[model samples]
Target: MLATAVESTSAKIIAGSDDLLAEILVRSPVSSLIRFKCVSKRWCSLISGHHFSLLHTFRHRRSKPSGLLFRHKPSLHPDATTAPESDFELVQLNGGVSTAPSLRYFSFIPGQSSVSGTIILQSCNGLLLCCSFPFMAGTRRRYYVVNPTTQQYIELDPPLEDGTSAIFLGVNLAFDPSKSPHYKVVCVQITLRSLYNYRIWIYSSKTRSWRISLESFAAPFDMVFTEGVFWNGAIHWINPYGASLCLDVDRECFRKMPEIPFHQSNLAGKSCRFFGESNGHLHLVEVEGPQTTQFQVFEMKVDYSQWFAKYRVDIGGVVAAFPEMIHSYLDSGDGNYYDFSILGVHHEDDEDESLLVLNIPGKIITYNFKNGNSKELVDFAPAGKDKRLMPQLGCFDIYQYSETLAPV
Candidate 1:
């Protein structure tokens, strides 16, 4: 009985040591941490505290992406009668398995039911910026910032305007737990009077309110504000027509990014295949012709000075392995098409460990930049009966997935 009592006392001492307990808890997976909250009030407070969340984020900041959330394109059939079987599918990366939250997770938000039509706009860190459209006309759309891992969310109303007609451009989420536990949502709106003039609205979780920025700026012609990636303490909006635009979130000011180095002739028929921030790096990929099997991966310098080629990617081996990726067109004059999309560029501390995630036809594969080898990550078949009516899997929207215990 004395030995049993001694062992219990030792366990209590270890549990009472906040620093030691936190060191162990920070290394635990988010799913386990969530369940650990029920152990006791002390454990609950420690795990949910902002300081602990920040520490956990810093510890796992270099972790590879857990998975990807793929939002499938809507049906294109003229007489479609029902919604697709599944609107979203989570594809695991690096052979890791994780649970994907469904629309039911959003039920906690007030006045939001039947969230089938809701769509994910962006995934920053571990939070998701989602939009839910009204079922009836004239009802204002709603925006939400959700932490799926924690099953917590907050609804945001549309930013108010000054009585002038404006088109809502896009909203992006910026969350860096290492810097602050709070997150910010950025909204862009353009005045109908001028195509180049744009206004910025920012929502701070700390303030729990939205405020309009005093700095209104004009952008280059055809410069799109959508898909602005937050990296290096700024949100960058890539422009194919001219110089891309960068907004310093901290300073609330606009700046021009270095011009894309590609010559006009090189980019004439090409498109921005992938533009995203991963592991503190911003990568851009462009593909020219339909059958093009070669391209360069460009990485932005840390100082925002310019972009340089990071990787010379040749996907000829992928085509040779997966013949379904080669699309032959008999009726058109255009050459055979290469069916693939660059989903992301994952950089690791070890340069040789870097991988380029790609989607080809019905399979998701990761291509090693160093060895030029390809490995299939996930294989999925088309959902509907008529495959031709469904859009190519590569066309689906892909969002990075990372687990976090940060509160919404």
Candidate 2:
């Protein structure tokens, strides 16, 4: 009788230790945690709680991105019959193990009968900013913030003041669970009054409403507002001509970004090859002259004072291995016909492990800066009729994917 009583007490002690159970559960992947909800009512409550989700995100905030979403641009040919059959492909980074959910998982969203109608605009942390457009020409596009891992989503209606005549510029997603569990979506639209002047609309998940910024601002004539990157609490818009813009969401104000350290004459010929944020770092890659194999990766300072040359990459070796990267019909004077696009720059806690993800003629490769080693991560049929890398034609749109349990 005494032994039986002791066994019951031990079982009660083990089962009552929720803190220990939470520690173990936090270490599990989001998928495992979802399945664990079925273990018991207490387990479900703990796993589905907001505080636990925030803790899970904080614990894995520094981990590397799970993979990348590669969206191929549709054919620019006038007579092309249809868009690419696949909306996007997931390129797993961690030993080919994919943790991020597929885009098709969004089928549960209301009115989303087909994945083809929805397009992913931005991926911040784990939430995806997607747009659902109607087949009819005059219908407005619907926006959504979705957590694919949890399959939680919220639809956002267009700003009340957004008129049909307003020219839609772009939208950006900002969510840092380390700072707060809430997320915000910023939408920019160009006003018809002037080409340079634009309006800003912001949506807060906390209030579940949209509001326009009190002030209107003008941007550089050449600024491409469509491609903004969210980093350091601001949405940054880069202009190759040295004029850049950033909107601080916390302060709800607009400011100018530091100029690229290059002479006007030098800047005229260079093009922005890559601009993105990963692991709390913002990097920019620019290529000049006729050699695309050699370029410098620039890192923006946390103070926003300047950009320094963080890494100098010479992928001539990549060119030598894949001769198809060399353009056959076109030459830019110097006979250096290298062709490639910098899809992303992934920074690791160990600098030696940092890598540059590149898209070449017929393959996707990762180039390690420390050792100048290149490895092909994926291969596909060469793009376009010329079988050339035409990034300027919008051939590829890449976004870093990280797994998070943050509720939408």
Candidate 3:
């Protein structure tokens, strides 16, 4: 039996077979091995070894373990001249003992640019997606996608020339192991010109060129990019503007997934944005309307459901605060989360004392809905007390990853 073998091997590892035993032990069920690590120091060292960590990362889905990227709020709105993003830090959210995030690391300096009122994000696969805040003067704004993990960035040219109103970009990062480089971007531009123009643009890393996607959706209002997350080779978005939509990058297609099942119908109040992936499907976190506006997560089980309620967010007894009109759900996955200042991290709290001013109770929070349970991750600083409001989440959603699945 597997148990008999596990017990036998558990007693027989020699000094010279560390690598072999480590590999063998890693092959065992993770929960079982993790339990054995508690049985003795030798097992602890073996399980927590660098090789084991790398193997776990290679086999299972592990966000860069560095920690969650804590985003800060602007004192006067991002557009204000006085409150430039002078410095920002990263806070590793510890889930073992407490949900409270302690400052573990940081990047102390001005964020990528001096421009005020820009969108900021800690993307999955370890990148910070950002853009300059728009001006009333109506100048075309610039955008940047920086991967702090690699210290590399792509500053996109101003979005499709929307000379009249405003244009915002949301990008999804996908990697196709089948391709040479395997990374692709699905950038959707939400612009209000004569109508709600839902334009999807794509950037192929292998081709090293950007092109207009053949796919377009009929959005009711301008579209907004959900958090740029990689799930089953597509990017997802919360379409409070129309029906919820998802874009597939490899196939270059548009399809409407299930909508969040909140009780109310007024699209104006529901703050639904793409959060992260859960159990291999896309998730939309919605700040439900009117009644209490509590936050909830809706999981899409079937990619093409034509609007069905898949699963509900099971919050583990924490207050599900709604997203302030100015902020939305962010997709910052541990190490590879949103990084600013050309990039950012989470370290000491006092390292960036300004963050100390950010209250953990307000602003926005992260929700994890798995195993029929939802747990609150981090509570960012509130944005209303002394401040000007910036364009937090607006007509942008779904960054599709171009990566393909291996042979079934």
Model 2 — which ten-residue stretch has the worst lDDT? 75-84
- Please, what are the lDDT tens digits per residue for candidate 1 over residues 1-408? 999999999888888899889988999988789899999999999998878977887777655566787654532221123323345556676664333545442555666554335556788888889866555655566788987777678888775557633346768888876677788888888756686877888889999987887447787766656678998878888677446888888788876578876776666688636889888899988888676899999999998799999999998998898877776753276677777778888887787889999877776789999999988876654664432223455322677877897777
The TM-score between candidate 3 and the true structure equals 0.51
Lowest lDDT sum, 10 consecutive residues, model 1, at: 75-84
Give one digit per residue, the lDDT tens place, for model 2 in 1-408.
Answer: 999999999778767998777887999987688899999999999988877887888887655577887654532221122323334567875434232335553567876644335667778888888776555656666778987777778888776553643335788898877677888988887776787888888889888887787447888777866678889888988777767888888789976668876677887678545788988889887788555667899999998988999999998988887787888568747675666777889888897889988777766778998999888876655545445644432323567877788877
Evaluate model 2: give its lDDT. Answer: 0.74
Of 2 and 3, the candidate ahead on TM-score is 2
Query: Which tens-of-lDDT digit does each residue in 192-241 have in candidate 3?
Result: 44366667777765566677775445565644464455666777665445
Candidate 3 ranges beyond 4 A from true positions: 1-66, 74-86, 95-122, 133-140, 158-172, 175-181, 189-194, 215-217, 225-230, 263-275, 278-280, 287-296, 302-408
Q: Which 10 consecutive residues of model 3 have the lowest summed lDDT?
A: 399-408
TM-scores for every candidate against the unseen true structure = 0.86, 0.85, 0.51
* Error at 362, model 2, angstroms: 2.3
